[model samples]
Target: MSMKSTVPSAQPDQFVHDHLPPPEQWPELRFDRPELEMPAQVNAVQALFQRAQQAGHAGRPLLRSDERTLSYAQAQSEVNRIANVLTVDLGLVPGNRVLLRGGNSVAMALAWLATVQAGLVAVATMPLLRAKELAAIIAKAQPAAALCDVKLQDELKAALAADAATAGLKLLVFNTGGAEVPHSLEKMAARQCEHSTPCPTAATDIALLAFTSGTTGTPKAAVHTHRDVLAACETWPRHVLRATPDDIVMGSPPLAFTFGLGGLLVFPMWAGASVYFPSIPYTPEAMVQLIGRVGATICYTAPTFYRQMAAFAQQHGIGKLRISVSAGEGLPDATRQLWKQATGLEMLDGIGATEMFHIFISSPPESVRRGAIGRVVPGYEARVVGEDGQELPRGQVGKLAVIGPTGCKYLDEPRQTQYVKAGWNYPGDAFSQDADGYFFYQARTDDMIITAGYNVAGPEVEAALLQHPAVAECGVVGRPDDERGQVVLAYVVLKPGEAAGAPLVKALQDHVKQTLAPYKYPRDVVFVSQLPRTETGKLQRFALRQQAMQTPSRNPTT
Candidate 1:
């Protein structure tokens, strides 16, 4: 079928238009609830800002750090001011993509809100991403401007310098601390009015372009609309998180991740609650300390971090924490039990993906189940289906398919065909539905590994490992471990002069850590003279996994 141009005026970036999958391939979208049905000219930012008008929250804190706090009114004013700069000063029209690079901070949150408020699509990149990864995203998204924290500008600058396509990119730096940076968001917004009107964007207009690492060792942009963002707030936070106006939220996941974006920024704001981003990245110990110090009532993080913080919270009382949310990976029963034992609070486990935007299958604390990953949340329908796309029996294991207000919409990639089939989004996870309708995770149908709740594609790790001078050839796979659920294991055939010893293993591991996110580095390495391969020269990852299973490992705890 030929591509039909829809909403051309709203998508000036031809890349977005050219990459959108055919309408038939899109997952079924529903706005069944009256609250879920947004008006035609709905701006999610304006809707979120309205929460400040709720009684008793006008002067209440909305964003807090150790150094300072911004009240609901103040944060909305800042968001408006930044939006003014983006639209009035920078001429960023609705539909233009603005790349955002920064760690989790108040400034970063403001920039994201401002980008969407101005009707521009936000493309947030992880701070740990290097130039090569940044370059790939730039090439795919073709963002016209970037808002970055000054501290995290080096790699983005290198990426822009290296890519000719981005040479003319508009670079705006934030969090400059009164420094005289030319294109600083602080400086730019200072000259703009603090009460700019929100853009009259349609509810279906694209709002964000979240890039996720794909199984093919490249990044794919997941497009989300204004309605989708609002729908996420309506379902998860309203139904599951159930935060109140008085709740104070804190978490470790970076805002660049969708999990963090929803948990730390969107959900709290949706409830007229406040969010606290630690001045610096918090260690599990520091996270526990901050929660107590700030009187945080709700917390969001992965299972591994919760495990590490459980003992710490017990040692120094968890203060006012009433809820602990876990996602990003499966929450181990042991971790859940340990946390419950320590905090006297049950951990809420949910499963969501970059495709779905946020958790669609989760249980409230009242409906807690021991090992199951909860029933499908309200506003979504999920089913386990066989290879032929037929729904399986309650106790059968098959691909997990779901339909919700938001679903997989990959930007200009053929992988969309694999992810969306018959109008159902396949999250690449294998699962089974019990008689009670609870979903039990089996394993990933793809090669992606979830270690410490971070998704690491094995091929991406292999690519990083092969870049090392000492590695002649390599195959990366996930080996089940007691602590992290799974740890990255690499089978390597070194160069002629390299020795197969502990130092070489350490060197290869360190090289991967330097090349990719620290969590993606191979935790265990085994030297091999050759890698199993097919006649076509494709590396046989199955054989490597088989070998890894046969070898005994010293399951090191993180």
Candidate 2:
């Protein structure tokens, strides 16, 4: 029963091995469909490009923005050029980790495809990450090199400079627009060959290292294989999303998030569809304007964004939109109904995680139930299990256990045992199954908070607060709210001289907003003299939660 690496690759870098869970914990991966079977030596990039070519849509648009549109053929060429630079120019061998930092842009997509094509694992980080946060990931993943947007290189540079672990990290910036920036990926790629062959990687070769805040509140890398990426495309988009070649997809989630990566890039490419990336991050109002202007047929975003944009969509008319997808958080009945009334499009609700890679349970518009999360996707199976890991009877709330083609493979973290047990991935969510096989949500089993569809780890927020000069101690917890389902609330013990008032509270809130994702900012700050701790000196988060629940509510704006 000892944990050991079951499958080792022929590549020089075996960093993935140091972090893989034991073979027995891995889900029983199956490929019953002929389309799902991949060759021993396969590159997911090659398969995606070949799919577009075989569909005879090489000339069709694959990526679109206000500035320009890239055809499938053109996109492939770009990918090949970047791949060439990664291998020939940079001397990046197979299995090397390439950290990618950027928003959802055409250049970012090209870099991601190039990394995979070159047989290197891609570690995509959100653009919102500050230097300290980036430093932690850098120390954990130890990526040899990075490809970043030129505009977003400051924090990454600072991170590398501050952390000795990233001392020699090489950075390649893109979207430099002929600026005299040295080592620009776009500039180097232009001179490289546009016909490099894809790396002869095994189907099971690691393709990505996605970082997720595990139950312990530390960032843990989730290992995903080339086959896993292909399988995701085969299931969700093929069965549920059902995007067609003619559909133009657009969304607000950054490509760094798996949901965004799958929804904005992988799914569209699988169907030979086009995806639109805004020149900048779109506000709720801006997203509606772009949807109307671009004539986007399929939309993907979180529940809160949908609620905020419903009126805008109604006033402006979203006539061209045929499908609206919601995930990242629970979709309230009110938000779903508002979107339906506004756009006449039923919001398809689903539950997914960075561990599974994509949605495993989702309903098509025709089979949707008001409160249920819907049936498991064709390639997956699920059940609710009690604390003892025994299957619970129908309609009983318990831990949600799932097994599918893809499952949790935490990179070299002890939490792997916690997430994967007896070949099933426990996603830390409480749920119940109905007689009809639909799954209904209950609550999160951990201290993580889902605010506006973004998973905010309470400990991560607490760590961020401790970094500020004003904080002596802190505990972060989720407070339930009607608008966002849950909002982050921080209980802080300020420094002796620091005042506890609206001004200091606002300062702490702004500090977190700047330090982490803006959505993770504490909506309410309660000043405390000290935090409750057990005899072992462990902060009693449950005690703090009880206090948070009893505190009088305040307007988030205040």
Q: Report clash pairs, candidate 1.
A: 19-412
lDDT (Cα) of model 2: 0.83
Give the Å shift of residue 452 in candidate 1: 29
Across residues 42-93, which tens digit of lDDT does each residue of candidate 1 receive?
Answer: 7888888875585667798889987679998898899989999888888877
lDDT of 2 by residue, 1-558 (tens): 111223446357888866687777776665666556566666788889999999998999999988889999999999999999988888889899999999889999999999999899999998878899888888888898999999989999999999776777789999887898899998899998779888877778889988863223566888898888998998878898899999999997778778888999999999999999999677778888888899999998877578679879988888588999998766656567878999888888898988999898999999998778789988888899998999999998788999877889988778888888888889887788999999987656677788889877776677667668787667888988788888888999887799888888888888888988888889988898987753212356677777878886653564
lDDT of 1 at 105: 90
Task: Give me the displacement of residue 36 in model 1, in angstroms.
Answer: 1.8
Model 2, residue 326: C-alpha shift (Å)? 0.5
After TM-score superposition, the amount by which residue 202's alpha carbon in candidate 2 deviates from its true location, in angstroms, is 0.4
lDDT, candidates in the order shown: 0.82, 0.83
- The true-versus-predicted C-alpha distance at residue 442 of model 1, in Å, is 1.3
Pairs clashing within candidate 2:
19-412
